[model samples]
Target: MLWLLMTTGKCNLVCDYCGGSFPRDVVSWSVKYDISKLKSTIETRDRSPTVIFYGGEPLMNPKFIMKTMDSLNATRWGVQTNGTAVRMLPESYWKRMNVALLSIDGREQITDKHRGKGIYKRVVENASYLKSLGVETIARMAVTMDSDIYEEVKHLVELGVFDKIHWQLNVIWSERWDFENWAEKSYLPGLEKLMDIFMQNLSQGILIKIIPFLGVISAHFTGGYRGSPCGAGYSSITVTPEGRVLSCPIAVREKWAELGTVNEFRLLEDPLPDYCKTCDVKKYCGGRCLYASNEKYWGEEGFQLVDSVTKKYLRMVISKLPEIEKLIDEGVISKSSLIYDPVQDSTEVIP
Candidate 1:
């Protein structure tokens, strides 16, 4: 099981597309979490748990995070950071962290435009520092209409820092948000460019990766359950500051998305909804984001748009598998570098 501790929902930066909201159930950041309840929750689980520190910016509650590491003695831990405030952590903390996912959208112009002044520089520096500390630092990009994935990835490659790169399409929770138009104009093109670059880089011995593409390919080979697009509420669950267990980090504020509390936890292991059963791309998509598919964002047109895009992405990556095999055979890329365990919610490298 993967336990996501939302240390604090207090982020220092507010980007344009962000909902800029936290779970209403959270207590103030000053109040320390009930670590006893958390410890008890972990003790009940049958399998060894993997811990992920999430935000607003998890580093806001540095003491709590450090103490969690001490009490749990968890080595399989990661942090989803905004790339600022990492400098506040001690050497011991950095050494203990296995993965640090630094959020950087693109180049300075693109990242700074959304995140704020000098963010790109700070994040890049932090990513480099994390690498020096031997933590696997991945550049997590939120792809939007304005994003240029190819150029952005190229920039990261030039910086010679990040150990890997992963991206997710920006989710617009507002009913008024026009994702359809954006998908047509920007999202699809950027993804195609990114796919091309991803393969080209691998052939040339660069290990950068686009996570979703890898996830789809991993599912294809592993015969793993691709249900729900992720492990939310199943293998992975998030806990808020107030002790509410939720499906995912983004689903924290969503009222219907709540599972249960730390003490009285519930895992809704329901299969795919009826509407998704007969879709051609069902296995590849595994059902779109469970929280998004709920009534708030579901409409026939919108559903179809997302479905088509998912299928397109799957097909594009599938077509390139032959080339990936070729690269592996030619010794351009190592087979060990590509790994996927669907149940683990992992499509990462050994590094």
Candidate 2:
């Protein structure tokens, strides 16, 4: 099982997509439950689970992270951070981490525009620093209208600091943009070009770890995934600061998302809706995202609009399978190279 421990609900930067920290009313700024209780609860469920530190900015409570890591006998330790406070937790602690996901949306201009000025540089520097320590560093991007997916992703790949790159479209929870126009005009076209680059890299014996493509393609060979690809309600769950276990981490305030308290938690029988099970691409997409499907943040029409992107993305990746197989057959790339992100370390496979 994958356990996402919400270290804190406080954040230093207010990114445009998420709008910074959760309200104190929704989630406490600091942890309210005892650390020993969390450790005991987790031990009862799974002796050595994969633990990932999550938050408004997990680094805000470095003490909590260090304390929890010290107490829990986790199989792996990972953090989804904004990359500003990498130094807060010393090098020794960082070297122990299995993965470190840094949020930087492509290039300096785009990232700074959304996150704030100087955030891009700081994130890149921290990513390089983490990479130097032999930690698996991932450049996580939140794609939006301002983003040119192909260019931004390509730029980050060229940086050579990150071990992998993952992106999620900013579609859920907030009516902010022209989804239809942006999808057709920018995102879809950018994805086509990005797919071309992905195949080119594969043929040249280089796996440019673009997770969305790699994850979906991996599912194609592994008989596909059920429920959420990220395992929101199935294999993965979130522990809030107040000790509430949520099916989806971002579904912070939704009553339906509240599974139970950490001390006495039970998994939902069927977190996904019936419509997801009946979808033609359910096998490949794995219901896209559990929160998005349930919330319907964009209404049915807008929800399907986002779903169209997933369908198109699925087709694009599936279309390249033959060539990818050819590359494998010719010894240009190996099958294992395509097998990535097996565990839900905060990489929502279907962007």
Best by TM-score: 2
- Candidate 1 overall lDDT versus native: 0.72
55-149 per-residue lDDT for model 1 (tens digits): 77888889888888888845387888889889777878889888888989878988888888999999988988989999888787776666766
Give the alpha-carbon lDDT of every model: 0.72, 0.87
Model 2 quality (TM-score)? 0.96
Candidate 2 Cα errors over 4 Å, as ranges = 342-344
Give the Cα error of residue 49 in candidate 1, in Å. 1.5
| TM-score for each predicted model, relative to the true structure | 0.88, 0.96
> How high is the lDDT of residue 304 in model 1?
68
> By lDDT, who's the top model here?
2
Worst 10 residues of 2 by lDDT: 337-346
RMSD of 1: 3.3
